[model samples]
Target: MRHVYGWLLLTPAAILLIAFTHFPTLATVYESLFSKGSTIRPSRFTGFSNYESMMEDPVFWKVLTNNFWFAVGTIPLSVGLAIAMALLVNRTLPGRSLLRLAYFTPTILPMIAVANIWLFFYSPDIGLIDQILGSFGIAGHNWLGDPDTVLPAIILMTVWKEAGFFMIFYLAALQHFPEELEEAATLEGASRWYYFRRVVFPLLMPTTLFVLINAVLNSFKLVDHLFVLTKGGPNNASNLLLYYIYENAFSYFDTNYAATLTVVLLVILAVLALAQFFFLDRRIHYR
Candidate 1:
């Protein structure tokens, strides 16, 4: 009777997951093997033709390369900043609550709104950055207009937005740390940095891994700010894989190609998940 009730409770969630997530993913894979259809022509199976075309597409390669650099640039810096912020806010200090709120405020705001605000900050001549530079006698340069600077500009905004959210996770991990460990370290005359490096960091490994995975997923999935800020502009300098998929599907009306791109993304994510399971699972220290 208990097993029957358990299966009944699980049925709705299982059905929803299959309908919404599994079905769409399988459909995308199926569609990627075909060619786009029109009124005169219907989609026909081409058997890896779309994948071949994707390999030949220069824009696809450019965007894929950009995504790699984007992940590399943002992940470590944001995670590092998060750790720093978490450490600072975890300590007892004056106006600690206010400081915590200030750090986390960016995380709550919509990315579109935040991107719009950053647009002004990156504007060439009349922007806030330029205005500040004018006072220092340094000539203002175009921040977003230049191909070289646009990716970095977007990366900076992403780090600012992401770090605080990661900080919250780190803070939660810090709170659960046993006070007796700190007391023992103090009795051993260990320096704060030494104690943190040798004792605290190992205990926080699980939270770090969790945050790292979230950061990696966010790198691929969150491209809303790109739409508002750069639109992958300055000759595809900041173009990311997900944004490229959007361009193909909506702007160009090439659903087959978009499906192909999505399949590639899915494969990449699957590989990452496998790696995390095989490698990181062994290292995580659970309480």
Candidate 2:
């Protein structure tokens, strides 16, 4: 009777998971093997043709490279800033609550709003950043227009947006640490840096690991900002893999190819997530 009740309890969640998550994943994989159908031509099994085409597509390669650089640029910087902000706010300081709220303000704003705000900042001459530059008789360059600057501009915005959310996790972790640890370190004449590096950091590894995985996922999944700020534009220079997948699925109406791209993305994320767990799990000191 207990086993029957247990099965009954598990059934709803299992059904939901299968219906929404597992089934879609399997369907995408299955769809990737077929060609896109139209009114004139029907869908047919292509058996990896879409994948082969993806390999040959230059835009795919460009988008993949952009995503790699985007991750490289955003993750470490965001994590570092998050840790710094957490440490600063975690200390007993005047107006720390306000400081924490200010740091976190960007995170709560919609990405579209963030993008529009930065879009104004990136606008030529009349924009805030440009106006500041112009004060020194410097000419304003279009931050989002130039291919060289667009990705970096986006990176900066992303770091600003994401760091505070990560900081919340770090702050929570810091809150749980016993004050005695800091007191003991001080009694031993341990410097702040030394204490943090040796004691506090080691203990925070689990939180760091959690934050890192989420950061990686967010790096790839973030697309709303792109839609508003650049539309992956100025010659697709700022295009990331997810936005490219969206273009293929919606703009080009090539859902089959989109499925292939999604599979690749899924594979990349799975590999990265698994690697992080496998490597970092060993170092995490769980409390």
Task: Indicate which candidate wins on TM-score.
Answer: 2
Q: Give the per-residue lDDT of model 2 (tens digit) for 1-287.
A: 99999999999999999999999999999999999999999999999899899999999999999998998999999999999999999999999999999999998999999999999999988999999999999999999999999999999999999999999989988989999999999999999999989998988888888888888889899999999999998899999999999999999999999999999999988897787778666533354
Reference-based TM-score, model 1: 0.93
lDDT for model 2: 0.92
Candidate 1: the clashing residue pairs are none
Error of 2 at 34 (Å): 1.1
lDDT of each: 0.91, 0.92
RMSD in angstroms, candidate 2?
A: 2.1
| Clash count per candidate | 0, 0
Q: Cα deviation of 116 in candidate 2 (Å)? A: 1.2
Model 2: pairs clashing at backbone N, Cα or C within 3 Å: none
